[model samples]
Target chain A: MYQFNLHAILGYFGQLPSSILVTLEITLIALGASTLLALPIAKARMSGSRVAALLARAYVELFRNIPLLVLLYVYYFGLAQSGLHLSNFWATILALTTNAAAYGSEIIRAGYSAVPTGQREAARSLGLRPAHIELFVVLPQVVRVILPPFANHCIGVLIGSSIAAVIGVADLSDWMLATGSEAFRYMESFLVAAVIYIGLCQGVAAAMAALDRRSRRGAY
Target chain B: MFATGSVWDYWRVFVNGLVLTVELSFIALVLGFVLGMVIGLGRTYGPHPVRLACLVFTESFRSIPPLLLFFGAFYGLSYTTGVTLSPFQASVIAMVLEASAFISEVVRAAFRSVDRGQWDAARALGLRFWPALRTIIGPQAIRVLIPPTIGVYVAVLKDSSFASIVGLVELTRAGLLVRETVGDSLTVFLLLSGIYFVINFTISSGALALERRFRFAH
Candidate 1:
């Protein structure tokens, strides 16, 4: 008969709270950094300036093609050898941010494209400042159009951050692995991790779904 | 990478690892596709209990992180059941299981996008359920499924790198091995990154071509 143990998991509840915080720290930083980078690249992709578009495309192509794990190694392991050593925490943030930016730019560009070109004409005819046109007219609609994919991007960022654990960053996955190895109760430790991930992801999905509906209902 | 041998020795090791990575990904994708179709069909058209089961399956798997799933499947299963899995087996199982969830979501969306009228009309024309799906709805759903399916494939390819963490000596692990001997982490990893980037770039470009083809056809 297979035996089950809850105590192994319950005992580690103490570490989990802080681990989740670290995970959130990485996730939020990456998301914010990526968004900062993504907006400009998305704009560049749509801009008629061929040079800007080419550079943006190059950035996306490079990051998109490389696996995140390889990027992690390059940032944490490779760059260190070259004498620009970042702590695992910063390295993870940088690697994940770069990756997230590439993907986010593509999604945001798609979102902008999905909007009808007539809207651009409307904004142009309004004689709005260029900045005002993007900030007020283009962005609001793009936000609605991109939210679903954006939510998926957030989830991907969350999952990809698990690689930070590989670099011994003490994030949720790292803590769980440590707990499992310490207790020799790997099953329980992993189950706790799985539960935490599920809860967080489901929470994101629910919040996104609600926002999606609310936005469609003219509550935005 | 040269562990007291020619540079070609380590290059051969990396090649072997890359081959294994490809094999594992191919198996996982094939299994995932079949499992996803089953879950998609069950969720969409099966009886009430089956649909509920499918929904639960897809959502739970989709929400969980692949790494967590990897650890859970690798250690948890053996801990509970006392049945051992090879590292490759465990990792591939984990990949297939989680990927099927995402793939099924893609399938479900694609299937849903097909008009309800088509389904009813197929039935009215005396087509049976499976035949109706195969003959009428399947082709249309394929269009919706293509981009996402390719996206998932690219994801799984990259994701297979995690198998290294679970002790599968795939490409990432091979690079790690090279670093251990050569003590030059950056150059070795940069090489691995370049190889992976090239392969993934090819995949994405192919997907773009396929999407363009679809657009031109339509």
Candidate 2:
């Protein structure tokens, strides 16, 4: 039986903190960018204009169907050939943002749909302006509806960011590869990385659940 | 600076890789369905230990990044067990494990979605457990089971691309190889993405049609 090597794995913990940050940074940036992009896409999808809705639908379908790793390679390597150079970090961010935005748009669109049309009409009849209705009447309910899936999406992004290591973005997966090779302890490093990943996923879940509860309680 | 026209020169290579990708995904989907069914049923109705084991298996596989799992299967297994898995074997194993985890959850939820009254009805009718499930409960749960199951298959198909990192010359890897020789990363990767999009889009559309066909008004 192969002996367990705790010492070699433990020795690599010093380098993990930064890689964890990189993973988080990638996840957060991508999440933010995707959320921003998703708003417009979702709006377009729900809008009255057929051309706009069709374009939005096409955007979501295109990005949703393509694999993230392939998207990353396109931005990281392929773009360079067209004289638009992107560092691995930016490339990863762009790919993840575009990919996640497709799903995010769907989530946001669902949230918007969940808000009954009667709610908007109710707001309008109250003599509220359109912007005020959107802000006070629509946004809050949509936020609540989207919270659970949005949390799940956040967790997905956290996990998906690991793909950044493919383009050598120095994230947690890259650290696992580096540590495994250097210490010749692939199993040990893999276990360590797996623990950190599971921990982060659970943490995101817990935090999101807490936020979801707070939003629910805050709602009337 | 674009050699987009030259990408089709390697159509044979792309076709080979595409075939491999479809074969890998189909095998994994079938095997994952089997394993996921077991785990899902076990989790829902088995004794305590079995349920716990099912939960742990599902959560761990779901929680960990799949690339990490692929690496563990490919490299960690050899290091610890002194047995080597070919890249294809390792990729299939990793994909099945991950896909089954997701599918098991779907299974458990779908099974649970069947009313408790349905089970009592089956027992009252003198139907035994397996017969009750296979005849009554299974049919009801299957509708809930299929659409998300197709979703999981698409996820598995997309994730199978990661198998390239393990040095499998699947579609994505084939594209990388072409890029290496063709020196047109833009054209090559675009071709790769387009092929993936076409396949995935078809599967999703077909799934939607299947779901509609299966729909019944309660």
Candidate 3:
């Protein structure tokens, strides 16, 4: 009979604190960098210039389609050949940022779209400069409306951070893989790893749900 | 570059890898869709235990990265069961299991998104439970289901790359082979990424077109 050993599984958590801290660091950095990149990409996507829109559209389509693993490999291996060598952490961060920016641009673009045409017109009617109108009026509402989806995307970033393991980053998944391999306790290590992921993802989802409810309450 | 292989020299290996990739993806898609439909329905309509099981399955798979699942299924199953599987079989099984969990959520949401009035009307018509679902609920639910279901296909395609870690000789593996042979890592990988981009782009656009047509038709 196959027995489930609870203590062995519980022992895996001895490594959890450090692994989770690394995972959280990756998620936060990736989300922040991606959001910064996404702002301009989203703006360009919604730009009046057809050329700008086309470039942004191509970028999103290209990056969003390719798997993050492939992108990671390309950055880690491909870029290295071109004399732009990056350490595993830098490579992972770059790939995650690139992937997140592509998706976030679309989310933010949808946010931009959600800001009603009337509001833009109202801002324009007030003789406010384009920059001022976007900065003061349209941008705020876009952020507000996009918060729920943005929260969901952040959750996505958190999950997507697991791909960092491929490039040899010592995130949670990498730790699980390493420990499992070393101990030859594949089932216990993997089950524990899966639980950690489930817990983290559920935490993210719960937080996002609360934010969504709060935003809904405040929405006009 | 250390060793050189002509494009023609590697074409056979590349084509073989492509075929295997396509086969793995198709198998995973069909099995995952069926499994997803069952679990999706169960989560929506099954009794408490069934629903909870489905929920646990979905969350467990959804949270863990596909790579971990691939590794776990390959080694963990072998370790626990003494029933060994070939790398290819293990890859397919792992991908299908992971894909099914995600597809289940999409399908369940699609089911729920259909109006409650549809169910009420079906019940009032005196049709039995199975017939009510088959005749009324299934058709409407499928129409709403197509877009997200296609989205799942795109997801599964991208996920197939993870199987390469277990030596599945897919597109990514093919690129790795080229890297090993030609020693030009950049060109080979860039080409592989382009291939993946094209495949995913085609699927995504096809799905989008179908979704648009469905919306217009309805």
Candidate 4:
């Protein structure tokens, strides 16, 4: 029978903070970049121009269909051959940001569709500029609709970031693999990593839930 | 600049890898659906304890990364139990376990979409529980079940790529092997991505069209 060894993994506890910080850094940057990209993709999809909408649809579909792992490889390895060398960290960010923006655009598009056309028309009649209309009129309503799914995607980026360890990014899962192999305590190391991930994910969910509640309260 | 000639030399390897990837995905999807049905039914109709158990199972699975499960299956299992799994077996077990947690929610939601009135009507007709579910409720619930289920399948397909990390020699791994031989990373990965895109896009678009058809039927 295999004995459980808590002490084996304890020595590596010092690496936990930096590992987590790397994961969070990847998650936050990717989330922000994806959200920014999503706005334009959603707008283009909702735009009157057929070519722009078609281009946007193609972008969403292409990225949505490909795996994050494959995309990461393309950025990390593929681009390096073409003479654009990126560090694993930045490559992971680019891959996650591009892959996630497709889903984010869909979520944002749904939020846009959820708001009535009459609202946009009304904003226009009030002589609000188109940019102001999107910002002031449509965005407020879209926020509540988009927040929960966006949070889920935020959590998704966090989870997806774990795969970055495959490409040699020193994130939480990378640390787990390193420590586990070094100590020959793969189970114990995994348990530690799992606990940290569950905690971080739950923290994100709770924060999103609080934001959701506060948004609803303003509506009431 | 795109070199198809060199990469094409490994066509047999890619084919073998593609077959294994599909085979892995199919087995996991079938087993996951069965497991999901049981958990989903229990969550939807069982007592409070059963419901709580199902909730906990799904939430815990969903919150953790699937990669961790892969590691747990591939490494942790052997470490703890002295029972080693082949990489393929480990991948299947890990994928099925995680996929079921997500699928169970889809099943529960699909079941719930059928109104309480339908249940009452079936009971009023003197049909038994399973009989009523098969004859009356199942048909209606299927409409809600299918499209999202396809979404899950696409996820499973995408995730099967992770098996390569565990040394399973699937499509992604095959691509890496070919890349090593050919020494052209851009061509190999782009080719892999394109193949994945074709399969995934076809399935998803089919699901969309089917969803539209169902909506029109309603």
Using lDDT, give the best candidate's number: 2
Q: Judged by TM-score relative to the true structure, which candidate is superior, 2 or 3?
A: 2
Considering only N, C-alpha and C atoms within 3 Å, which residue pairs clash in candidate 3? Answer: none
Model 1: clashing residue pairs? A78-B186
lDDT of 3 by residue, A1-220 (tens): 5455656556567778888888889999999999999989998988899999999999999999888888988999999999999999888889899999999999999988888899989989989999999899987788778887787687778878888787778889888888777777777787877788888888988887887777577567
lDDT by residue (B1-218, candidate 2, tens digit) is: 43444777999989999999999999999999999999999999999999999998987888888889889999988889888899999999999999999999999999999999999999999999999999999999998899989989899999999999999999999999888777889988999999999999999988888888777535
Model 3, span B88-168: residue lDDT tens: 888988888988998899889888888889889988999877898899988888998988888888888888888888788
For TM-score, the strongest prediction is 2
Looking at model 4 chain A, which ten-residue stretch has the lowest summed lDDT? A211-220
lDDT of 4 by residue, B5-118 (tens): 599888899999999998998899999999988899889988999999998777777777878888888998888999989999999988998889889999999999999999
Weakest 10 consecutive residues, lDDT, candidate 1 chain A? A211-220
Against the true structure, what is each candidate's TM-score? 0.94, 0.97, 0.94, 0.96
lDDT of each: 0.87, 0.92, 0.85, 0.91
Candidate 3 RMSD to the correct structure: 2.1
What shift in Å separates residue B86 of candidate 1 from its native position after superposition? 0.7
Interface DockQ per candidate: 0.75, 0.83, 0.70, 0.83
* Model 3, CA-based lDDT: 0.85
DockQ of 1: 0.75
TM-score of 1: 0.94
Candidate 2 RMSD to the correct structure: 1.8
